[model samples]
Target: MTRQLRTGFLLALQFFSVIPVKKQLPMEKEYITAMYAILPLLGLLFGSVLTSTVWLLRDTTEISSLLLGFIVVLIGLVLTGGLHMDGLADTGDAYFSYQDRDKRLAIMGDPRIGAFGAMALVVAIVGKIILVAESINEASLVWVLLIPVFSRIGLLALFSFTKSAKPDGVAAFFQKRVSHKKLQLVAIVALVISFMLLIWSATFLSAIVLIILLFGFSWLYRAWCLRNFSGVTGDLLGAYVEGVEILLWMSLLFFV
Candidate 1:
């Protein structure tokens, strides 16, 4: 169990971020797929990175909370190497171009940023900064800390449950390589963790609210994927993560 966990953790670090793993670590695709279980933990790590900035600077007279919050979000971007954000950009450009589905996929494959992509990037970045700051100011550190954790779980759920649009790219590789049993177990674990976090931070009612909304959103996103690109892609997954992360923050402000 220890060795399996270590292997999964190492693979999680390799896949989710640009962090350098130990030279002794193996890069097994099976481990990479199994590593989905660790995404929530990886998110906890990320949440710590962003929240530590607030905790460290909260007592400072010169550093404004707003600035600290922005710094935290910026640090998050750096931590992840902006990989998901890039996907979000590409997804926005591709999905909103109103072209044929094939052309849209082709657009996402391109390195260039379109107008829609630029707009989506601005919204996501700004929304993250603002909502993060608000949550901090609200002293909702628990929610902030768990937001990434839940978002990662959300990402894993999307990857596991949805069909790959074109059976191409990294998303396809993950879908194909991950075994069903492992995927189901990991997703269930993540869902259980999500419920625990929500219940810990808020009332059971609030937790139930979130649970219901996520199911609804998941169905909607799946439908959108079917209509737009025939199925989900890495970019769409990233977009879902960002969208859900911010929505989770906002939802807690009212529901929690």
Candidate 2:
């Protein structure tokens, strides 16, 4: 169990971020399930990096909020190596192609980006910048840290509840190995920890609103994925992560 948990943490870091993990690890069912189970902590790590960046920039520099927002977004892209963004682009292209399910999946598997993908990337990136610029402040840095946490929790919930669209790929492979009950337990614990963190920050109202919003969006996104793609894919999951992060940030604008 300890070895599975350790390898799972490394696997999550290796797969999701630019963080280097030199040693190769086994991808057994237990390890893969542990990977999904440990996924939200990956978000916590990202949140720490983002929060530290904001703190350093705000303390030392006089940059405009827009530039700060841009920097924050850039750091995210760098950290994840644009993995989720690529998923967002592929998802956009596939969904907007208006083709059959197989065709849409094929389109998503394509290396080239389409007009819709470009547009989706533009809209998502620009929207994030604007929302972050507007919402960020000293008092709200905690919210920024919590945003990725909630977004990842949403990702975990989506994965636990939804079936994979394809027979093969990262999403399908991991989904096949994961234990639904264990995944649910992890999601509950993550949510509880995040909620407590929010309350600790004295943003009790924000905590409630964010949890409600996360679950609502997760449900809607699952339905959308099932209807459009037959089920979720790695790209779809990535898109959900990106989409929920933005939504969470936007929601913070109301309170921050």
Best by lDDT: 2
Q: For candidate 1, write residues 1-256 as lDDT tens digits.
A: 6777789888888767878885576546566665877888899899887667666676455676568668877887887888889989999999889999899999999999989999999999998888766666665566667778877877887787888877677788777767756766776777787688768876889888877767777778878888899888888888888788778767766775
Off by over 4 Å in 1: 22-29, 59-63
- On a 0 to 1 TM-score scale, where does candidate 2 land against the true structure? 0.96
Q: What is the C-alpha lDDT of each candidate?
A: 0.79, 0.87
lDDT tens digits by residue: candidate 2, 147-227: 778888888888888888999877888888889889988999999998898888856787788788888989999999999
TM-score of each: 0.90, 0.96
- The worst-scoring run of ten residues by lDDT in candidate 2 lies at 135-144
Clashes of each: 0, 0
lDDT of 2: 0.87
What shift in Å separates residue 139 of candidate 2 from its native position after superposition?
A: 4.9
Q: Quick one: best TM-score, which candidate?
A: 2
Instruction: Give the range where candidate 1 is weakest over 10 consecutive residues by summed lDDT.
Output: 22-31
